[model samples]
Target: MSARNAMAAMLDELMGPKRNVELGKDTKVTFDDPDICKYYIVGFCPHDMFVNTKADLGACPRVHDDNLRLEYPKSDKFEKLGFEREFLKFLSRLDEDNQRRIRKNLEKLKANEENGQKKEDLRKLRDEQEIARIDGEIKLCMAEAEKAGEEGLVTKCQELVDKIEQLEKQKTAVEERLNNTATIPPPIDESAIKVMEVCEVCGSMLIKNDAQCRVEEHLSGKMHMGFSKIKVTIEELRFDNGSRGHLLMLLDISVNVKDGDHVNETDHVIEIGEGGLDRVHEIAIVAEVVRATDIVGMIVIGVTGTETIATDDIVAK
Candidate 1:
């Protein structure tokens, strides 16, 4: 399986089943059947009433009070240290086996980070080595030009100098990246990062915050709509065998009409469902059968004459 799919599966296993917590009238705060305090799971729960007033209360913590209602951390704070702290707290709450699973996932992430760093270091080393080689070549060319004092040798030496200068500039840029401590951010544990869920319709992975909007957009998209239409057509085909023609017409099928059998635009009446055509407006034959494989049959077209005929509307005749 792919790395992303594996990680998703591991995350699903780690999270287990979702709790069925119901939100009260406020909607901002969840109250009913709270198996675990949301804030406690996130490393903090400041509801002192649960501790002081109800010392031995068996029921869940009541967060209905205006002061007690938990507010989500600011987006910036969550991006910074909040996620890591909360995830650690969550790990602490899990059983030994669950924690072991989480730790294994974390180790894999750390190994990936190390591997990435090693590759980047190797690339930088190669670049530096290339720069050194270029510098040495430039020096050798300069010595040859000086000794020979030939026009061609001088030109070659200048070219080498120009090439070395470019290499040196690149080397300096690489050095800057290597030396810039401020630009080097601390390595973060991948487990601290929020796990994303895959969209069932589009097969795209998305974070919880943007999942709803993405899912709605995906459902309304042309590809999804087309698939939905195809699904409906299949269902219709299964139930209404005689009405298959209507669905086929919707798809703009090309029928092969028999040889010598011709349809007159003025004479034939088009019937769609219970309605009949008022008049036969126009008929244009796109192609005549020039091959033996082409079907040769009477093409009976049913449509309201006033309706506009598309290029795809013409069937074989």
Candidate 2:
């Protein structure tokens, strides 16, 4: 929607209950009414995604009429509603914001990982020092036992030997504790509470490689669902815009297949349009040349040039 249109819609939607009555008395309802949410008309509204959650995009200030939404796709004004462009712009901003959040979250996780390792190292160091102290005490006791034995004090020497044995057992206990810290199991990053990471799309906390069930549960959650819907809708809107409201199976332009590079056979063609087959359009979304063969229902033609496709290779049902 245009800026002027959006402003007018916001004003009208925010009108007081009394003003709404007055407008109804003086105006008529139309699908193109400024108060209707264009995003909703296009498909799903982003505002509905995070209700009751931290990412909640509070209530939308515009009207969301189901009737209008249903009628929009079939409306004569469907082509270039401008709302689709606006929707794409809005989604792009959200995507950028989410990306920033992911970066920030990763920094936190990195810090947490460092702190966790430091804590473990410190613990192991303390344990090793305690064992060294015990060893030093045992060495002194052993020397005393040797001197006592040489002086013909058998009882004192036996006592020193028993004391050294107790110290050795105590040292063994500390060594076991140290070994536990150096084990292979993944330790909890107490700084982060427990291996927490950010969800790239929703910016919410997720356990790194969490249990499959928990992962599924998170994906199905309202916040994730909301962001996922926005992403899919944005893709559809871009596709519609590029194909001019027609669902055209265009080549994935990003592949960048060079000329005569052995165009590989496809399992299935990649489609990117949303229109019915009734529309009189017939261009295969493929590379600049050498289109898909055996198009059973439509004429397949090269989009970039009039490259010769075999007459017998294409048939229309």
Candidate 3:
């Protein structure tokens, strides 16, 4: 962690919940207190998740207490207090900022890929030209050695031979490098290519066809966790609503409609008799209608928040 972040964390400890309760002073703190961190009470705090990252939000300004967080759900207000909304709104803003950053990075990467390949081609062409020039020099030296040998200047001929040998070695090295540079790597699978995408949850730019472990690590990272927590909390609030009490059941319904005698839009009135009640065996909820009930008498109910519904089979608890 950076020095600044470390100090911020230290201050959070000294001045937050630790100061309020652990210091032995009588502190009458409640979950509803403005000083208490509501984000922590609802779930994970976004301020704590992004520390030392480019998205670092610094330390949470409010006090974080495990006791207070536990007490929050049991409070009279709970979801009515708007703590979840506040937390959701803040995280959403953070993600929005991150999405902009991700878009910029994508633009840069696209431009760089083209430019980088052009640079690589230029370098290869230069290396090839150097090898050709060196080969020409070697040929000239060989000609000189031939001329000197005819004149019986043995010493000069030998020096020319040595120079030609050195040039040949240089040419060989360049050719080897050129061959290696020209080599094509094995093709990657198309299925693997599709896996890489901008993470909608955390607004991160993931590597294209990254290693499995690295992808797993990214999925489990703090930023991902921070964003994923939003969905979990929303689901909790949804299920916590109706009388069925968050029940999940395996349902198989085949209904024959008789007549739509009366119209009750609040809950569909299913005339499927006693068998429907036995299958669900749970409290009731709300749903929509499919006109008259003759061949379509099934008033199948889907659970939704803050609405109470009744049917012949399922009763509101």
Best by TM-score: 2
Root-mean-square deviation (CA) per prediction = 24.9, 9.8, 11.7
- Please, what is the TM-score per model? 0.26, 0.63, 0.51
Pairs of residues at least 3 apart in sequence or in different chains that clash in candidate 3: 257-294, 258-294
State the lDDT of candidate 1 residue by residue for 1-317, as single tens digits: 46776555445334422312254433332222243354443333333212322121233232222222233332323323233233333333322333354465556655766777787788667757766775777677566656555555666666666775776686677567666634544459743344444433223334557558776886676434433443443344323323223223322333433333344443322223223324342231122111112333334444444563432234332
Could you tell me the lDDT of residue 137 within candidate 3?
Answer: 95
Query: Candidate 2 at residue 275, lDDT?
Result: 32
Tell me the tens digit of each residue's lDDT in model 3 across 74-171.
87665656576566566556756766877877776667666767877987898899998998898899999999999999999999999998998999
- Candidate 2 runs further than 4 Å off: 1-19, 23-25, 30-34, 153-155, 182-200, 208-211, 241-317
State candidate 3's TM-score.
0.51
Give the Cα-based TM-score of candidate 2 against the true structure.
0.63
In order, what lDDT does every prediction score?
Answer: 0.41, 0.63, 0.61
Model 2: lDDT to the true structure: 0.63
Cα error, candidate 1, residue 311 (Å):
97
* Cα misplacement distance, residue 136 of candidate 3 (Å): 2.3
Off by over 4 Å in 1: 1-96, 150-167, 170-317
lDDT tens digits, residue span 1-317, model 2: 57786666566655521245553375544655666777777777788777798767776767876766787778877744557656667777776777777798889888978997998799888888999999999999999999999999999999999999999999988988888754445538543445688888777778887899999999999978877777776666545424433232222222122232333343222322333322223233232122323333322333323333322243331
In model 3, which runs have C-alpha deviations exceeding 4 angstroms?
1-32, 52-54, 65-68, 74-76, 101-119, 149-154, 182-224, 227-317
Clashing residue pairs for model 2:
247-273, 247-274, 248-273, 249-285, 250-285, 251-285
